[model samples]
Target: MKTVISLLFIFMVIVGCNSTKNVVTTDTVSKISDTVKIANEELEYEVIIIDPGFSSWIAGRALPRGYYSEAYLENKNQFYVAEWNNRVAQPMQYDSNLYLFRIDYDLTIRYGYEVNYLIYNYFIYFQNRYNQRLGGFVPKQ
Candidate 1:
């Protein structure tokens, strides 16, 4: 059986800005459908991330692939996933649109490098794009 983990981000333009000051203009948003699929056939696991500017952000703003080890990425992903799930559980406290679904990340299973890399960068893109922090460390390119 295939364990497909889909983390869907509902895209919406926020008119007003708050403390974060990460203003997303119309030009900044990608016109094309930015759908990224991270799959490991051996593990029978797949992760689909659907967000507007994620493809462009990953190509231009994300750090190089070799910059961080798989272990590091996995660790960061664990923390990010935890915070993401927390927000998903509380719709009233957090934005229901943004935190629509909880990410199913199993720490025991080794999802390989590609899966971890994309997941980690997606978290970074998510935090910077949405002006929300999931972990203690600052989200950087």
Candidate 2:
């Protein structure tokens, strides 16, 4: 009877320990994933901002600024031309804003570092990969 009681006590302690470890492990994983997501998002935002085509037009021109406070979808194309209307200039000139635009957006990655690589690399990889797998920029036919 004494041996039986001791064995059951040991088993109960082991079971409790396992449950605690699992809970801690799950929390840690959730935290890491959240961090990676934030980092990836920031990387995307940087790519969109530094892009020469859009950066040029964004500067010196009085226009409505798009959402710059957060990560936005990046256009896969390295070079892009978007239509912009400037009525202030005599006989409004329609200019193109260059940068790949994103049609869909994910709000998860607002800040942090991703496991794959530096956040910026994600943007660079995206641009390079898209260009490699698909055809490059060309004016509409």
Q: lDDT winner among the candidates?
A: 1
Candidate 1 C-alpha lDDT tens digits along 1-141: 111122344422112222232221222122346776654433445566777678888899989889999889989888888898899899999877678776777766666676678778878887877788876977577
- Give the worst 10-residue stretch by lDDT in candidate 1: 21-30
Q: Against the correct fold, how does model 1 do in TM-score?
A: 0.75
User: Per-residue CA lDDT of candidate 2, range 20-105, in tens?
Assistant: 11111111111221122221221322211222222232233322334221122223211211111121122323111212233122
The residue pairs in collision within model 1 are none
- After superposition, which runs of candidate 1 have C-alpha atoms over 4 Å from their true positions? 1-33
